[model samples]
Target: MSYIRGYDPETLRELVDARECKDRLDEIGEQRSLPALLERVWLLKVLGRLEDALVISEQSVRVARMAGTRKDLLRARILHASVEQQRGAFAVAEQELTTCAAEAEGKGWSGIAAFALQHRGKVFYDAGDYDAARADFKQALFLRQDSGVPDAQLESTLHAIEAADQRRMRASVAS
Candidate 1:
């Protein structure tokens, strides 16, 4: 069954229809066309349908693995972690991100490592562990900077740091 769900990206639509995505996944057989299937997964993610994304991502990972594309498999795993993070599955998200991070570090994929750090920091931020969040964000900032990430990402990460600090301040005030 192909995993081609009827996905409307508008948040208002919010119709991920995991069944549809799952059905469409079977469309991509062992023909060696990964990018197209990856597109469908990306669309599901853009539409805020995280569970669907995870499902499709898993399928893509399997395809990549069977196709001998280890990098793409790792990408799928990292993206799955992102979905978990969004769903507040913090520990699970950390496990995914940590493994990806380690792989990135070992493979010298600085860009991937930086992205993992940023996403992990977000998980920490949502968990209200400001200290851990700050550390993660700072590490991300440094990694991105060292990796020559674009200025836009740098600015956004800086804003995230500020936001994390403000949240910590609010918590202190409340306490």
Candidate 2:
């Protein structure tokens, strides 16, 4: 079982107790394993410790490059870009995610491609580019569907699409 729980589908932000995350982090102390580092980065990001998250995320990317497979590197890059995105480095996150998505697709890794596209859509959504966000989400949904991912994963993209549409409608109405 995973220590992490209750992350928002659209934003991938944790909705569980911060104390639980802190406890998990403590348990993972001094562990430099890729999974351990990735968990630390995620917990830090969710706790609003963006600087620490960024540093750890970069380290995770380096570790993945040195010891992990290409897929692992892509996942690490995606996580690092997410930290960048939360740090308000929208352009950097967008560029990285775009590249990750393209690479995943080229490698015939539909699940990884969908993951990258979903995150890229979030970057666009956070930047107020709802149309682009929706487009990416749609593409991700297609990929996920084609890849026969679980219902929860498909629902996440579906929820994202609905959210983008709602936000777009709201912006138009307010304008």
User: Per-residue lDDT tens digits of candidate 2, residues 48-78?
Assistant: 8999999999999999999999999999999
Q: Where's the lowest-lDDT run of ten residues in candidate 2?
A: 1-10
lDDT, candidate 1, 118-145, per-residue tens = 7788788778888887888898898899
Q: Compare the candidates by lDDT and give the number of the best one.
A: 2
Candidate 1 lDDT: 0.72
105 Cα displacement, candidate 2 (Å)? 0.2
- After superposing candidate 2, which stretches have Cα over 4 Å from the reference? 2-12
